[model samples]
Target: MKDEKIVGSFQLMKSLNKSLILNTIRTHGSISRSDIAKETKLTPPTVTNIVNELLEEGLVKEWQTGSSSGGRKPILLKINSSNFYVFGIDISPREIRFAITDLNAQTLLYKTITMKEEMTSSRLFQMIAKQLYIMMDEACIELKKFVGIGIGIHGRIDADEGSSGFAPQLQHRNVPLKKELEKEFRLPVKIENDVRAMAIGENWFGSGVGISNLVCIKISHGVGAGFILNKKLFHGTNGLAGEIGHMFIESSGLKCSCGNDGCLEALVGSEGIKQRTLNKISLGYKTKLIERTNGMIENVNGQLIYEAALEGDLLAKDILEETGRYLGIAIMNIIHLFNPERIIIGGGLAKAKNFILTPIQEVVEQRALTEQAKKTEIVLSKLGDQATVIGAVALVLNEMFSVQYESVS
Candidate 1:
């Protein structure tokens, strides 16, 4: 027992030290071994040993020489970002996106495929596996060079179990995403709620970079949010911490998919916008939406409404402004609760920023409790359409670089 305990302690300490040195090199972009030792507060010998191991593993490489004060120039080190790869997958209600990225999260290849209606769990697995093989063949990188796979999927996720507890869009429950993907690909897999993954992506590589407290809101088929508190993703007790879409806003508003009345999602989701536009059209409001949709009321959609709004259609403008105001209310609630450093808006509705951003800013400016709170930065996602997919890549990178504790067996 004593021998086992000593071995476990050594392993844990060694892992932690390695992570420190690796992260130092990653953050600096190019750093010398001595600098890494200084940054990580590890001994030079320890840094040298770990860095040698990383170089042997193809995780890092020594780069050009650095300027020196008097003695010989020191060799700089950097992540061997291109030597290893990760697969990022985003599964939405309408489509699935696949991307291959390097250690630095730079995308090398990407593809999107439309989702078949009424997809079952088995079908989902097969489709993803097929796409993975296709992308692998296209990249022509050896299988050993690919590190892992990451997935950003909608609905309630049991991240610990690597399964979707319930996916409202697919109407599927308890799908073992990690197990099946790992088995098929013979690689590690990480899965998280799509919105949460978006938040991670933004934090790592987009607008939220360097911002410790941030929130990412996705407004498309539905409204969802991901929270980053104290520089870490905060998953509530049941992994449902950021489900702000169902927050009650109006007592007698439209019915939500969750069987709730006047939820934020029902008020501002894409479906909500479409429904509101239809109601206005039914009330005989004058608008170019009718012309844009070519007299097909069923064809009236968010994009069409945005086009009409751009053409100076008052009714379309009013609907989008109303949507913005509703979103602002929810955002205000978020500000009061989480007080994030910034809030980033992504997904389809974000494309309508010109029409809706003002109303949202107006609401926040008028209602926030303090001057700083009112001035809290709000911006569109820098990652845009690729936010979630890139976030999936971040999942794998985070696990690879962060410290972890494991039981010795």
Candidate 2:
């Protein structure tokens, strides 16, 4: 009985030790074995054993040592970023962007596909596969070297079934994107909401790198958000925790795409901005916009409206003023509820920094409880368009830490 107990304890300790080594290397790249041991609270011999196993699997590599103190210089060890590549695709209503990246989230190649507003899911999937094939061919990547594919659709993703739950942009419901692709590529597959993917990218390598409670809000094509609470991606029970777009602010307001009235996204999405501006222009709202750009609806985005406001376009300025005011109302709600540390704005429309952010900051300060509003900071996403792709890569890398998340090959 004592021998049996001892053997079981040994196995448990070995497994725990292996996890520590892997996690240490993941957080601190190019760390010496000694440093890893110190950080992971592992014996040097145990770390060496795990490191050797990982090296044999091509997951870790020993780098030439940099300068050290007078004592013997330690050989630097790092995760082999080139051991395999990951494919990430962001499929939107107007465009599908595909990128191939190494394990460390460095882009190797990228391609884009443009389509009409009302397109079918089947055709879109085929186009995506074709584009991905071309990108891989251009990059000269062998099929075996690619570990798997990750797709970021601009909707809620049920990754367990590899389906897009309610992607209004795709005009399809419950499309099993990853499952179908897995059959064709013969590799593992994962799908995520684009907003959540952006948050993942930030969590790994961007502004949210060290922060715990944060929000990544994107306001292009539509307004969506992803949340990081206590350093973990908090997906509510239905994977819809961060679906703050439909948070009701106006009960008698215009009908939203989600069949709701007065959603935050309904007020602030690109469509809303476009419609509001055109309505004002049609109603003889005078502004320098006509003289400035010669009456071009083509030139009017949320940012253009901000610029027009700055350039003395009364109509454009009014749009921003109202937009900022509404945004603040929504932010006040978030502050009271989440009490987060930071709210990082991303997406195409966040370009109107001052016009959008100032109002939001003001509203939060005025409306929200003082202490709650003080905790959050509204800012921009540094990764920009790269966030979704980088986040997809981060998703795959994180799976290694999960005991149940399996590999493809």
Candidate 3:
């Protein structure tokens, strides 16, 4: 027992030292073993040993020599961004988007395909494989350089098993997405909730770069949130930590996909906005939407409503203003609960821009605690349509570079 404990301790210490050394090299960019030792506070021998291991693994490479300081010039080290590539895929209810990116999350190829009237798990996986093949062919890169494929699905994901238990948007249950992809592509796979993936992407490559505590709210077919707390994605005990869409917003609101009434999703999601617009029209509200859709109310969607508002349609503008207010209330609730450093609004509705963000900001400022509101910067996602796909890539990169050490592969 004593020997086992000692062995475990030694392994833990070695992993921690390796992580520290790697992080120092990544952050400092062209760094030497002595510089890594100084930044990580690890002994020079430890830094050198770990760096040699990383070099052998091809994760780090020696760069040009640094300036001499009255002695021999030191060799600099940097992360080998081209050593491996990650494929990111975003599966949504209406469309499938995928991209190929380097270890640095720089997108090389991106494509979007609209979903047919109905989709099954088999069809979905086949579509993903087809696009991946096309992307790889276009890039003409060696397959051996591929590290893994990351998938972001619009639903609850079993991270450990890489399966989805329930995806209301997909109307599918218990799909073995990860296993299927790994079998088809013959590569390792990482799967995560779409919004959560976006949050990871933001933290690693986008706006949340230096910020530790942040929230990413996605509003589209449904509402969901992803959190980065204390420099880590906070997955609650049940991995449902960021399901803010179901937060109670109205006591008498319409029914939500989760079978809840008055949930925030029921009030501000894409369907919710469409339902509200239909109700207003039914109640004889005046607007150019009727003429815009040629009197086909069923044809109205969040995008059409936004377009109508842009065209100076009164009802459409009112609908969006109300949607923004509800969204603001949601943001206020997020502020009071998490007190995050930044709140990012994403998804299809994000395109509403000032039409939606303005109202959300106004509500948050007026309703949330002054201190929390002041500290939290609410802004639209900088990634736009690429957020989820980039986030998928981030999932692989994040796991690869995470300092937690225990989960590092």
| Best-performing candidate as measured by TM-score | 1
- Assess the local accuracy of residue 208 in candidate 1 as a C-alpha lDDT between 0 and 100: 92
Residues 1-409, candidate 2, lDDT per residue (tens digit)?
1123222111232365665676677677779888988887778998888888878767678887769887887888887878778888877666777889987788888777677653455665677678878888899987777766777778743334345435442323424566457667766566777887788778777768777777888888677788878777776665666677788877635677767788888788887777678778889888766666676765667766777888777788788777778878877787778888888888876777777788888878777788657547888788887788777776765554432222221
Error of 1 at 332 (Å): 0.7
Q: Write the per-residue lDDT of candidate 1 for residues 18-52, one digit (tens) a residue.
A: 77777788888899998887877888998889888
Rank list by TM-score: 1, 3, 2
TM-score of each: 0.90, 0.84, 0.86
lDDT of 3 by residue, 4-108 (tens): 322211123246567677667777778887877787788888788888888877778998774677776778999887776889999887788989888788888
Using TM-score as the yardstick, the better of models 2 and 3 is 3
lDDT of each: 0.81, 0.72, 0.78
> Who is ahead in TM-score, 1 or 3?
1
The Cα error of candidate 3 at residue 275, in Å, is: 1.2
Among all windows of 10 consecutive residues in model 2, the one with the lowest summed lDDT is: 1-10
Clashing pairs in 1: none
List where candidate 3 sits over 4 angstroms from the true fold: 1-17, 65-74, 156-175, 184-186, 404-409
